[model samples]
Target: MKTAGGSDAAKRRAGERAAEDVADGFVVGLGTGSTTAYAIRALGRAVDDGLEIRGVPTSFQSRQLALEVGIELTDLDAVDGLDLAIDGADQVVDDADAAAHGALIKGGGAAHAREKLVDAAADRFVVVADPSKLTTRLERSVPVAVLPDAHTVVADRIRDLGGEPTLRDAGEKDGPVVTDNGNLVLDCAFGSIDDPDELATRLSAIPGVVEHGLFVGMADATYVGTDDGVETRHY
Candidate 1:
């Protein structure tokens, strides 16, 4: 049986290729995840070669990685806008209406809220992932960041919305896993979402919901790594 090495190699290739898009003097929005970690390394190498670019990292993990690679960093507010954002998604589905566009579900690392904010601030958002991430529709569970005080209330609301919500627990510790923003995550399963936009709207309307992983019509392009090579899709 084939293990995940192929997939991991694919992610590294996709990340390196995505990093090639970063140009000198550009302010890049660094995203989180294993795939984006490769991008960070590539970007760091470019920085060593004197690529005068600055990075705005979306997560603490990303920030540390960028620093280790010697990528110059700055705050999001310090920059007018990001030239590009290279990130990864848990799932990518083609838009039902427009085949060119993709609807993404992210936050597998529980950093979707910050990822969305940074991605939205960029002039171009690029998602890099292995081909395994592509799907006909988003069937994976959606991750919703909720205020700690409203975790139970939000889970109840999600249940009423036809989802099975589970409060994400920490792997090492006993209590729940808290986010950088001091929020908790609810992994809500709604099966294969036929209409993600509609569901996203409904989830957003719920009080105490900070942000969800349903990224509707946000991807400018996606770089998918396959057994053959990297495939590029533009939206």
Candidate 2:
């Protein structure tokens, strides 16, 4: 039996297309999530093809996945500037066709902060995702990373902001799901996030809050994959 890793093969092919866009010998920033799994696999193929590139994964899961795929990995301290970052976006949209201008909600893997660190260090941040994620406005479904000791206090603070916060879990494990950064994650549902930038900034400012998963102005361009094919929207 030939299983397609529980994801569509065409989606994986779309990741190949994006990987082809990457030049050899550049420091790449790897992202986390299911969609990014394909990208990492594709990038690994590139490495096998004799590209002398080094990868810096955004999360421990991403790092492990990259190693399994044959991509040479590196640490942040070893590299000063990242040439490119190929990762997945939760959502995307175009603002008047003046390149792509849509905010994104990420961090489902609880590695949002590390993703941001790599994205910020990169020269170009390329976001990849399915077409269904495109939206005119950013909705905050981002899992907020916090300390377990302050989960209740943080949830209350979020509730005061009209957000019903729920502690993210790994299916009744008798405890909270811990992030790669060794913090607890809160899967927050704040309805339609009217202002993602402001909300992200505010949430990040809160104490005990390690990082929020919303990525604003962090993408240079986005590649949206559809059932038919893929398309690029530069921002």
Candidate 3:
């Protein structure tokens, strides 16, 4: 499914702005999604202009895009540390507290597992989004990647935690949407999230869950794209 967010122009503005922070000798974590695709392209131009950098892509889609854009690819295991990670959010809660300022709901693309790993390993993780992604509170569905065999059990556990879990199906294909890691995704709805961190912890403790979409305290900043320009928010 296409990710729900702002206009394509706004997304491009935010993404390009985030790419400005990548230095000449940096190792970047390239995230998946339409917003992040702009950043990858921007970085590609920079590389064409003699900027030296390597990228660790968070998903197969991202890796393919990076290659097409002429951005050199590297595996996460080969990188000692990533200088930065440019990513997108499905929804971002604007909180006053710095700790929760950029609390995000991701995985609309069902790549949260790899995105989380690469993003968390970066020295700085920046989120790019259109204004539509910003919100007073998080009310979006949280996606959880689970082992195929444990999907039913995980759904029961998610229900015990007061969430409604639905297996994400492939829209064009006949079977369920399979992730790069060969797992099934369960999109869980829990109305408005009161404590994202607590919920994140609980989701992580689930036996079969590979990763959950609640990215609490991961983003260092967010660049929100507007019709006119981009607004940067530090978390």
TM-score of each: 0.95, 0.90, 0.97
Backbone Cα, N, C clashes tallied per candidate: 0, 0, 0
Question: For candidate 3, lDDT tens digit of each residue in 95-176?
Answer: 6763566899999999999999999999999999998898878899999999999999999999999999999999998989
Q: Quick one: RMSD of model 3?
A: 1.9
lDDT of 2 by residue, 1-235 (tens): 1233223654565576667777878889988877778888888877887888889999888999999988889988798889988777665655644222656787766788788889889999888776556787666566888887888888888887778888887775787888887899988888777777778787887778888878888888777766667777776
TM-score of 3: 0.97
Q: What is the lDDT of residue 103 in candidate 1?
A: 90
lDDT of 1 by residue, 168-199 (tens): 99999998889888999999999979889999
Please give the lDDT score at residue 45 for candidate 2: 78
Ranking by TM-score: 3, 1, 2
Given candidate 2, what's the lDDT at residue 132? 57
Candidate 2 lDDT trough over 10 residues, lowest sum: 1-10
Task: Please give the lDDT score at residue 38 for candidate 2.
Answer: 85
> Which parts of model 2 are misplaced by more than 4 Å?
1-7, 93-100
